[model samples]
Target: MSVNPTPLKPSQIPQEAFDWYDAYAHGAMDRRTFMKKLGTLVAVGYSMTALTSALLPNYALAEQVSFNDPEIIASYEEFASPDGHGKGRGYLVKPTKEIAAFPAVLVIHENRGLNPYVKDVARRLAKAGYLAFAPDALFPVGGYPGNDDAGRALQRELDREKIQQDFVAAARHLKAHALSTGKLGAVGFCFGGYMVNYLAAIDSDLLDAGVPFYGTPAAESLRKNIKAPLLVQLGELDERVNASWPEYEQDLKRYKVDYQMHMYKNAHHGFHNDSTSRYDQANADLAWERTLAFFAKHLT
Candidate 1:
């Protein structure tokens, strides 16, 4: 008696090669096992590659010379603190090949610390032909507390004063860098965002433009010293922080600061972060576009 071939489910096909396979094909394990294993490995490898690419999008661009590209070149450097007690460390991203001075952006990382995401952002800025510097605010305090139970523990012990000092020092370092365009701008997310706003208000001479996404400050009086153009991104769905944003915007308007505010509907606090559950791709993309545009218009 002749036996029918065993049918294979569509789910059985590896995701990587599913597009190339015939959906109707059915067979026993022995017939397709080799191909299946190969497909599975390929699928796994591809997934890992894509994930890695997303995390380190700037790797290739960082090392190459691309004037038209927006990926920034990353280099680590140490800056002497203004107080003269210790040295502050920061990562700088700049155009690989450029003759004249280029616009510079100072990026501040979130509470999670100076991770790959921040570096990628600096790379992005460099790719866009801007010199981007991301200083380690938590350096003096011993580094950032990544997102986890341990992170919370570190947050409680973070030294706010030292962070502020480090930020100021980082700005000074960027200004003195030979490749810097001298026209400096600042951008930060979450904790970094808060510091950006604070820095704008405190050190107006160091920045020509500032973009703060979902950052909070201890005092609004800092707004009086702001001398740069500001773009603030807010998420309406962020219940914890949304309440105070109105007041912050009002303060800016009240002070007659050159600023723009954007509120994304249904977005959360960490909407700009693609790696988090709170990430909202649509809003994040929009925010990035707005950020680059703002920097170009103001800094360049």
Candidate 2:
């Protein structure tokens, strides 16, 4: 008889493992170093595969809302991005009931390209009766490449300025979409979150509202020009990202930017990403509820 190894629970993992995983996921640590460190951290009985399985995102868990859900319609669409990669593509979703117009939002992905988790977020927004678009930053380089490590490497090769312009193009395209009511909002995680802040700063009139989940703020020069209301979410234990918060908050207040920030206790970086062991279900739920309400108040 063959025996299967029981899946390790999150509680069994050490905080250092989660921290290292975060660094690895964000591209701060190379795969070789991460694996070597991970080998040392994992318990003796557990295999490297088991440790990695627990650390990396399982896209299967990302499907909170189904792709075939009856309430929403989803598709891939291409849009112009002359200033970016010359062109861009995205996953667009909208309510199936068909209204004359709908409020639109741009869903931004992490350092990796537009993965299933981001696409699912678009569906969730559509199911809530809003038009949502999540663009693939890697489209010009052959899309997501079916895995995060490759996706990250591809993203790193592109000109960051052009990529930023790609997102700017995506925001413009979605806001002016035929089905859009011209009320535009944006929500992004990690790198996407940073993009939200960047968009709000550079193009003051672009976004009516913005939500950045554990992302770094834009440059001070750009941030001073922000016009949109913002909902900033952060994890208390995300020391690397949180280190910039005090200075960022000072600027927000000095400039009188319409913004509110929430730091979830006991949560780590990527806390809202349910696909990984760092996810805090309670914190994620509360943050999402707050995000939806914030959008409703501002986007509508």
Flag regions of model 2 displaced more than 4 Å: 43-46
| Top candidate (lDDT) | 2
Give the per-residue lDDT digits (tens) of candidate 1, residues 160-226: 6776777888887887788887888889987788888888888768889999988885377677788
TM-score, one value per model: 0.73, 0.97
Steric collisions counted per model: 8, 0
In model 1, the worst 10-residue window by lDDT is: 19-28
Superposed on all Cα atoms, the candidates' RMSDs to the truth, in angstroms, are 12.5, 1.3
